[model samples]
Target chain A: MIRFDNVTKRYAGGHEGVSEICLEVDAGELVFLTGHSGAGKTTLLKLLALIERPTRGQVLLNGRNVGRLPARAIPEHRRGLGMVFQDHKLLPDRTVFENVSLPLIIAGLGRREIARRVRAALDQVGLLSRESSRPDALSTGEQQRVGIARAVVGRPRLLIADEPTGNLDPDLSLEIMMLFRRLNGVGVTMLIATHDLALVQELGGRRVILEGGRVSGEQD
Target chain B: MRLWLTRHVQNCLAAMGRLVQRPAGSLLTIAVIGIALALPAGLNVLVRNGEVLAGGWESARDFSVYLKPGEELAQAATLAKSLSANSNVDDVEIISAEAALADFQQSGSFEGALTGLDNNPLPHTLVVRPRPEAPASELAELARELGKDTSVDQVRLDTEWVERLNAILEFVRRGIWLAAGLLAIAVVVIVGNTIRLDIENRRAEIEVAKLLGATDAFVRRPFLYTGFWYGLGGGLFALVVVLVGLAVLGGPVARLSALYGASFQLQGLAGSGALTVLGGGLVAGLVGAWFAVSQHLTAIQPKI
Candidate 1:
């Protein structure tokens, strides 16, 4: 469902965030990006979300060239994909339910439908009991799960994450990884960026390795 | 359609909730907006009151034509008859020189001073009251024409005070409009700055919202509602200020009018006037919020 043809993103001051990155992942396929810090993993994901544009070459999503999406169309492009962050990105002031329901609210879903879908997503993430609790009250792992619940509440077919397990302990990280595997079992495509090679092997997915802002290797 | 309404309702409530959460800042911003809005509204109401007070005396369109000394009472009588025949002239009362002297001498000190005179020096005077419906220019033209007559030495309009008062009122009215326009800009700036600070404080929330597939409009809805509330609140507060001012001044104004030989009631804002002040505040608030969000929202992309 995704393709990048030699995409290059060069920041100002001649620093390359990502360069000459040609990649592809088939629909419903789960792929892990393995790299150290500043290896351009986040930049690659950002290109897909149109958060940052490629300085050269084409980036295609499904069959459409999305590298040059007009400013007005960026939101619609993003709405089709679920995104999770390492920081959880939950509003501390709001209830966990409100955090998860944000995407549906943006999509203009009815209030009842929002409640139903939010409950279902929360149930999936094992956060069903903490819906009314604010993010600060939830454990770090629970907060990450809340983020995952939010990402999936819209029922988007594609999901992307930038180091989703970066902040959790190994036990919690394994639980979150299993959660991703469980989601993949049901036909959701995912591109996850991470630095844990052993866990990448444990998850048993195709791993694309990045080094010095370029894709260095691929292993199945 | 229902979903749209529900979403908007939620957004408005959320905006209000945010404002309520930060009571001190919100109240300060609102107080500034209220005072800004009240300045122009209060001034406009005062101008209305001035117009009402001025209304009493502007209609005094009377004048006196003093005939030349040595003019016979018969000549003055004939002059008054001709003036009365003019369509603009409502009525003219002829005061013979002998009658003028006797009326003047009846007043105490003036009689003592004029006892040395062998003959009455007061000239024959014609007190002319013009038609009430006569336009100002028409009345001035009639006075000029009367002064040109050889029988008349001077044509003195008693309503000159009214003209001077009208000029001062018009000037003040213009000044109020200029001040209102300036203060309108001030209101917009105040709101814009407040919204900008609000956006900065909620920067993380905005980044998260945008990352979660929220559009600019989706992210902006709350701020817009905040502005809407600010404007609506400011407008309401301005109405309060105006009413309070009217109440405080009402008694003194009535007494002042009484001293002037008239009983005047102070009129507060009419319905339309209140609406106008409210509407202006709403527009300014919305505009300020729009500019603030448009300029700053895009600058805050979720940095990877």
Candidate 2:
């Protein structure tokens, strides 16, 4: 479903963010990306999200080279993938329901379909009752749950969570991981980038660890 | 394209909702824009009103011919009748010297001065009212034509006042254009600066939207709509300001016109001028929004 061939990303001022990385993930596979801070884990996720272009080589998704794709085609490629952030990033002014319905709205879904899908997504995250509440009015955990609901609401084939549990306590982090596991059980491809070694060992999925902008180890 | 427009409109509405959620800030912005727009609009009203007053003043005077004192009354009367029948003249009133002397005697202030006269000192006069469609230069030519007659002493054209009034109107018109130009520039800068501030404040949200595959147009639409509302609301406020100003000063204007013996009407924004005021506001808003969007949208991206 995704592939990278000798992809290199360099920021200005001679800083090498990611270099000579080659990797692939099969369909419906759950993968954990573990790396220390500034080890290019975020860079890899950004490259896959089409937010940053690789300086060299190519990044491919669904058999099309995204790095070689025209800038205009980047959005179309991103629509197929779901992304969650360390910060919930919920629109503070919007109700939880509205935030969750964003992707479907962007997709031009009708009002009825959006309502139905959003309700289902909220139900899956146990946030159906809090749909009318704004993000600021909710607890941090609930807000993160709303973020999760929004990410999955569009039913994207691939879900990327970049440090999704970064700001949460251990119990809350495990709860979010359980939510991810629940999502993965339903055949949604999941890639989680985190530095939590204990959590990774507990989840026991395929792990790819990065060291110094390169993939240093992997274990099933 | 349809989908894009639909979403864009929704995003605009959303932005407006957020703006309204903070009423004080919205009001402040609207007031600023309104004041700027109203300056030009109010000046335009003054220019139009000046033109109307000048037009009325020009319409008052007619062609006057002073006849030679020795000319026979019968001959002078015949000439007046002929001139009255001409296609160019609407009316001709013959004022004989005797009648002119009597009109001077009727006023008690001049009665004693005129009582000592042996023969009527006033010259026989012919007053000519030109056709409504006659041009000013044509009327001057007509006056020159009347001056060549053997029985006529002098032909005084009523055109000098018209020329002077036209000069004043031209001055006011130029002033209006200058004021409008300056005000328009002010509006663009004000709106642009406001939108730029808004873009900076919402930089995070814009970055997130772009990262989610939203296009520049998509991200920019909300801000543009915000600017549009600013313009539209400001325009409406400006219209209100102009009308209120006219209403407050209406009595004074009427009094001033009455003092000058003119039944002048001060016109408010009507027809095309109203459209222009509204359009000006809208254009300012759109342009300001465009500047901010073009400047900020491309520079933001997800974390490096």
Clashing pairs in 2: none
lDDT of 1 by residue, B51-147 (tens): 8877766447678899999988899889888888989888999988888888888876697778989888899999888776666688898889888
TM-scores, one per candidate? 0.89, 0.87
lDDT of 1 at B213: 74
lDDT string for model 1 (A31-79, tens) is 9998898999999999999998999989999889999899889888888
| Residue A53's lDDT in candidate 1 | 92
Candidate 1 pairs with clashing backbones: none
Residue B127, model 2, lDDT: 84
**Whole-model lDDT per candidate:** 0.89, 0.84
Candidate 2 DockQ score? 0.43
| Residues A1-220 of candidate 2: C-alpha lDDT, one tens digit per residue | 8898999999888687788998899989999999899888989998888777899988988888888788877766776778999997888977999888877776678778999999999999999999999899998888889999988988999999899998888898899999999999999998889998898898898999998899999999
For model 2 the local lDDT of residue A199 reads 88
Tell me the lDDT of model 1 at A2.
89
Q: Give per-residue CA lDDT, model 2, range B258-296, as digits (tens).
A: 998878777877878878999999998888888878987
